[model samples]
Structure formats: C-alpha cells, structure tokens
Target: MKKRSVVSASLLALCLLTLSSFSTADTLENIHQRKKILIAVDIGAPPYGMLDGKARQSGSDIETAQLLAKDLGVELEVVPVSGPNRVPFLLTKKADLVIASFSITDARKKVIDFSNPYGVIQVVVGGPVKQKIGAFTDLIGKTVAVTRGTTSDMELTLGVKEISGVNIVRYEDDATTNTAVSTGQQDYIAAAMSVIPAVKKANPSRDVETKFIMKTFPLGIGIRKNDPELRAYLDKWVQINLKNGKLNDIYKKYFGVSLPADMLN
Candidate 1:
C-alpha cells in the first residue's frame, strides 16, 4: 500500500512538471497562432504613451509596441494600464507584454522577469524656478505631488521618511499630477523626467524646472516569470533596435534627446 501511494505521488508530480513546461513554450507560440500580441501601455503618461488630437494612441511607448508587433508579424492589441496595474495585467494574462515605462527593480524581479532594458528615465524632483529645492533638505515643509505606485513615488517616499516636514501628495496618474502642479494645487512634483517637460510646456508661465534627480532606472518590458521563450525574444529585439537607432529615433521624436549613450552601448 505504501509503495503504491509513493508511485502515485511521483506520477502526479511528473504530470504537473510536464504541464508547466508546455505553458512556458506556449507563451511565444500563442501569439503566432492568434496573430496578435497584447501589450499593456499607460496611455496617460505623456511622451511615453498618450492620445493624439484624433484620440488615437500615440507616443514613444506606443510606437515601440507597434514596432514589436510589426516584427512579430502579428496584430497589435494595446491594453491600457496605469502605474499600479501594469504588473497585475501581465500576471493575470490580460497582457502578454507590459511596455508601460515599467522600471526594473529587485522587488518586482521576484514576481516577474524583465527583458533587456529598452529605455531609461530619471526620477526627478521639480518645482517652479523661484523656489529653492535642490535637495531633500530643501523639500522640508513643501508639498510634492507624485503619481501613485510609480518608481518616482517609491523613490520619493523612501527619500522623505527621515526628513521631517516634507509633504508628499499622491495622484492617480501623471496627467492629474501635471494638473495639480499647473493649477498650483501642489507646490512641487516627484515624477519622471518626461512629466516635467509636459508640465512645463502646458504651463509655460509656471517655469517648472527639475530641482534634483533622485535616481535613474532602466525601463524593461515586463513578462511573466518562467516564460523564458517570451523573455528571450524581447531581449534580442531590444538589443537589435537599440543598435540600429530605431529606438533612439523614437525617443528623440518625443523627449528631444537621443537615447543615453550608456544605454545604447
């Protein structure tokens, strides 16, 4: 009886392992079979993803997703995601890839794998030119707006804990944060470098300028952990595009600067 029970357990384990292997391989083949790749993008984040005057999706991230679909020879279906939900969308199978300006971090690596970085962004502290905010000490007693659940949010949160009198206001997205800054609802903003330009252009009279850079993070395409096939393809795709200047062109068109030399290398 004992021997029979042990043999049954071994067979069940083997069956589960086989199924896991099949699921991993399906990550890539499923796209080819369906002729569509579902990518999650944060359309509310300007310069990365946004809607144009025609209400059509347009931005660097949008173009990157389109390029990936073109190379895969598949139709592109964009799944709109926000900072808080990009990982959830990928893990829940709502998106096969997340190209939503997701910064690769150690905490996230434990849950999902990331492809080679396709872009980089600085977490910045920005305020009007007349205000003096060059460091955390400078932020004392000032309210700084930040998009919820973003790397900028995390960085700023960690940065202000030990520093007293710094007020951090959380918003749902960059658009809302931009509004808060433009309308004087908030004194400053903790955000990506991209958001600064958008806010500055929209409110030219505000003269918003970056005060200090918190840290730079590499942006990676988020994929489910254990999906080796998908990660492999994305890794190769990023390398080729970066080397060929296609990615830089997209960055320049939106951000007015070439991709960082360190990233291109």
Candidate 2:
C-alpha cells in the first residue's frame, strides 16, 4: 500500500510540472501551435494602418503584419487598436504584436519590449501654407491640434521646452484634427509627416504642409515584455527584410519614397 501511494504522488508531481511548462510556453511556440498570429494596428492612421473602401484592412502596417504572418507560416488576424489602446492590447495578451506606428521612447520602454526599428517617422508641425509656421517655437500662443494621447500631442504639450503659451487642441483622431485645421478652427496641427499628404489628398482645398520637424523617431514592432523568443524572431525578420529590400518596397508603396537612411542607423 505504501509503494502504491508513493507512485501516485510521483505521478501527480510530474503532471503538475508538465502543466506548468505548458502554461509558461513562449509566445512564438503558442503562435506556431495555434497557426494564427494576432497583430494590433491603428486602422485610423492611414498610409501606416487603416481600412480601405471595402472595409478590408489595408496600409503599410497591415502589409507589414501580413508579411510577418507569411514568414511565420501562420494566418494573420488584425486587431484594430487606437493609439491609447495599442499598448493595453499587448499587455492584456489580446494581440501577439503591435505594429501600429509604435515609436520607441524611453518612457514606453519601461513597460514593453520593442523589436529592432523597422521604419522612421517624423512628427512635424503642419497647417495651411499661409499659416507662416516655420518652427516649433512659431506656434507659441497659437492653437495647435493633435490626436489625443499620441506622441505628437505629447511633444506639443510637454516636449517642446523652448516654446511656451502654446494652446493645444486635442481631438479623438487624425481625421478630426485635420478637419479642425482645414476648416480654420485650429491655427495649426502637428502630426506624422505622412498625414500632411493624406489630409491634402482628402481635402484639396486645404493647403497644409509640414513646417518643421518636431521629433524624428524610429518605429518599432511592439512585443509583450519577457517574450524574448518572439522579440528575437521579429528583430531577425526586420533585419532580413531590410537587407532584401522588401521593407523599402513596402515603404515606397505607401510613402512614395524609399526608406530613409536615418531609420537604418
């Protein structure tokens, strides 16, 4: 009876250990086993990520996610996330990765792991050509619009030290912010440089142009913290694509130019 009891106890311990290992499996293993990878993208930010006329997800970020899925030999599932919620989606395990124009910053690095940079984006002050906005300091005491909770908003609100008395007008999304600028409701708006062309294309009457760069930052793929295997995979994928010119092709398709040199550095 004693021998039988010992065998039962050992078996139970083994079972528990096996379950623990499975529970702690890395994201890469889970993705491979599930045959699908969920990626978070901002469908509202066009030229980077957004929905097309057919409501199908289409844009640079969407294409990049598709390429990643292909490389992983898995199906792609895109989760539309806004600027504010992109990090939360990854933290909650709702998405395996976030490619939503996520820029690397010292503050954000504390909470998430970012893959090697895949692109560079410039945040610039944009408004009507006649607005006479030449630099960041020029917006002093003027109403500047930005998408609420975005890097652009943060820069205008807190990053620009030399400027003071700038009135920031926050909106829910880029379209709304652009509308305010286009309609003369806002003095000027700051956003991704890509947004200037998008806004001009959408509203031809609006003569918006980038006045000066507020900040230039490298955009990285967001991976959940402690997922080293997944992070390594993404970093390798970015390096490979960059060497093969596949990444530049994607950039040109959306931005009308090759990937900039500074992004690689």
Candidate 3:
C-alpha cells in the first residue's frame, strides 16, 4: 500500500510541473502558437510609417515589421500607435513589440529594453532660410514646433531651459507639426532631418533647412524589459538583416539614402 501511494504522488508532481511549463510559455512561443505577431507602428510618422495612396501600409518601419513576421512564419497584425503610447502598448501587452521609429533613450531604457540600433535619425531645428541658427543659443526668441510625446519634444524642452524666451508649440502628430512650421504658426520645428524636405514640399516658400542639430538618436525595437527571448531574437534579426542589405534597401527606398555603414558593420 505504501509503495502504491508513493508512485501516485510522483505522477501528480510530474503532471503539475508539465502544466506549469505550458502556462508560462514566453512571448515568442505565444506568437508562434497564435500564428501572428502584433507589432506597434506609428502610421502618422512618414518615412518610418504611413499609409500609401491606396490606403495600404507602407514605409521603412512597416516593411521591417512585415519582414519580421515573414521570417517568423506568422501573420503580421500592426497595432497603430503614436509616440506617447508605444511604451504603454508594450506594458499593457497590446502588442509584442514596437518598431515605430522608437529611439533608445535612458529614460525609456529604465522601463523597457531596446534591441541593437538598426538605424539613426538626426533631430534638428528646421527653419526657413531667413532664420539663422548656428547654435542652441540661436533658438532664443524663436517659437519651435515639436510633436508632442516624442523624443524631440523631451530633448528640446530640456535644451531650451537655458535660453530664455524660447517658446515651443506641441502638435499631436508629425504632419500637423510640419504644417505648423509651413504655415508660419511656428518659425521652426524640432524634428528629424527628413522634415526639412517635407516642410518645403508642403510650402516651397518656407524653404526649410536644418538650422542646428539637437542630436542624433539611435532607433531600435521596443520590447518588454524582462523578455530575454524576444530581445535576443530581435537583436540577432536586426544585425542579420543589416548585414544582408535588406534593411538598408528599405531605408534607402524611403529616405533616398543608404543607412550609415557603421550600423551595417
């Protein structure tokens, strides 16, 4: 009787252990099981993500997400997000990861992990040719427009404290912010370097150009901090695609220039 009872207890323990393992399947496993990977993207940010004339999703980040899903043999489900909500979406499990031109910053790193940087963007103060800005001090008395809830906003906010009378106007999206600059609502905009050409196209009279560079930020994939499997996979995936020229192809297709060679290296 004792021997039989002991054997039953051992079987029960094994069953419980097996159930626990299945219940704790990580994010990658869950994605595979569902046959879909949800990637958060900001469709409002052009060059990084946007809607084509036919209403199709197209851009550098969109293509990168598509490549990720294809390589993983899963369907891609994009969760449209803005700059502010990308981290929230990840924290709340709304998506597996964010690839929406997410720049890696110390504050963000404290809350989430970033895969190795796959690209870089120069944040600058863009203005009309008549307004000159050779240094940060030049921004004094200028109203700078920036997209709310973006790194550009945070960095510029901090940067202008020493320069008195530097006003900043915030907009909800990149398009609106660019419009503000083109329409003379703001003399300058703190945005990616790509914004200059966009602002010029919106209103040729603006003739926007980079006045002064705030800083260059490294763009990376945003994942939950504790996700070792997803983080490792993404880091490797970025390096592999960078080396293979696929990522650069997407970057050049949108920006008309190749990614920096160092990122590939």
Candidate 4:
C-alpha cells in the first residue's frame, strides 16, 4: 500500500510538471486567442503619433493603424513606444507590429521583417531660425542632435564620421532631440519634414527653420521575422488602403500635401 501510494504521488507530480511547462503561453498565440492586434506607436513623434490638445491620439500613423486594424478584423491596441525601444517592444511581444514611420534598412531587417515600402519620408536638417544649415557637408565640426536608432542617425553619423571633427548627440526620443536644437543646446537636429510642423507648434518661439537635405527613404511596417502571415496581411491591406484613397487622405490631413505618386504604389 505504501509503494502504491508513492507511485500515485510521483505520477501526479509528473502531470503537474507537464502542465506547467505547456501552460506558459506564446505571445502571438495569446494575441490570436484573444482576437486582438497590438500596434506600437511613438507618442512623442508628431504628425505620426502624438496627443492633440484634447489628449486624444491623432496622427498619420494613428489613422493608418486604425484602418489596418479594421481591415485585419482584429481589435486595435496602440502600444506607445519610444525611438530606442520600438524594436524591443515588438520582439518582447508588447506590440504585434510597428507602424511608426520605421525605415527599412538591412541592419533593422536582421532583427525584424518589414513589409514593402508604403511611402517615403523626406529627412531634413533643421537649425535655429537664425542659423539655417543647408548642407550635410556644412554639419562638420558642429554638434547635431538625432534620435537614436533612426535612419537619420545613421545618415548623419555616416556624414559626421567621414569628416574628422563633427559631433553627434543622440537622444532616445523626438521631443528631447527637438528640445536640444530649439533650445540652442545643439546646433542642428536631423528629422522628418512631415513632423516638423507639429514640433514647431510645440515650441512657438524657437525660431527654427528646416531645410531639405536628402531625398526621402522608404517607410514600412515592422513585424517579427517569424510573422510572415501578419506581414502579408499588412501588405495586402496597405494596397487596399491606397486604392481606396485612405492613405492619400491621411497624408494630406497631416502633411497638407498629397503623397507622391510612387508612395501610393
């Protein structure tokens, strides 16, 4: 009787261990199970994702996210993320995808997959209104602030490094980086033209003006490398959004201009 009782306890222990091992859930599976989709947003990046005076979210990416979720038939949940942590959010399962003006690059592609480029964003160099810097070559020997982990950072770093004396100051978010330049702490800030108007509004007396420096690059949604199905869904839905004029309307509403013809395709 003692041996039989001991055997039963051992079997029960094994069952419990098995259950515990299998019970820990996968994030994507949990999301699918719950019938919801999570999209990461950079609330600090205006004209992309930011709170208006009413505290409600409004931006190009916010509107795009809503449309994407509607077409996906999943509940949309926006997960706010900063510049440096956006990829971490997606990798850790906090966000199912990122629609936050993320650029497509080979370095980023190693960690996360991206859909075909939906649009292109022109990167510009801005300085205090009195000190307008027009060219990348001119940035040498100057201090420039750029958001960490962005293509702008990479582009500027490449330019700065090539010149022997330039200094690159990196920040984790757009607001801080903008503050650095507008407050006269940094000489210039590398940023997107689409979002500059909103930043200008935030700092009314900064006397800042921006100049177009480089042509824009492709922007696309980012997902984990394993999520091919999700990426395909996004690719198809973006096409639909373009055809229905939703993408163009969103761009015009935020940027005050229609998207380039190539951007729609």
- lDDT score, candidate 4, position 254: 82
Instruction: Compose the digit string of candidate 2's lDDT tens values, residues 1-265.
Output: 9999999999999999988755632999999999999999988888898778898889999999999999999999999888878888998899999999888988889988899999888888887788777776777777788998888887777755666777887898776887777677875788999988887877788888898888988899998777878888899999999988888889999998888875544
Per-residue alpha-carbon lDDT of model 4 for 1-265, expressed as tens digits?
9999999999999999988754633545556787888999888888888898899988888998888777656798999988889999988888888989888888999988888776668877777667646777777677778899888888777666657767788998987887776666876778887555655666677666676565477889988876656666678877887778888898889887887886675
Model 2 alpha-carbon drift over 4 Å, by segment? 1-25, 159-162, 262-265
Tell me how many clashing residue pairs each candidate has: 0, 0, 0, 1
For candidate 2, what is the lDDT?
0.85
Give TM per candidate: 0.91, 0.86, 0.88, 0.84
The better candidate by TM-score, 2 or 3, is: 3
Better of 2 and 3 by lDDT: 3
lDDT of each: 0.90, 0.85, 0.88, 0.79
| Candidate 1 residue pairs in backbone clash | none
Runs of candidate 1 exceeding 4 Å displacement: 1-25
Please list the residue runs of candidate 4 whose C-alpha ends up more than 4 Å from where it truly belongs after superposition: 1-32
Return the lDDT, model 2, position 134: 78
Q: Mind giving the per-residue lDDT tens digits that candidate 3 earns over 1-265?
A: 9999999999999999988755532889899999999999998787788888899998889999999999999999999998778999998999999999999999999998899998888888887787768777888877889999898998898898777888899998787888888887888889888778878877888778888888899999999866788888998999999999999999999899998888988
Which run of 10 residues does model 3 get worst, by summed lDDT?
18-27
What is the alpha-carbon RMSD of candidate 2 to the true structure? 5.6
RMSD, each candidate, Å? 2.9, 5.6, 6.4, 5.7
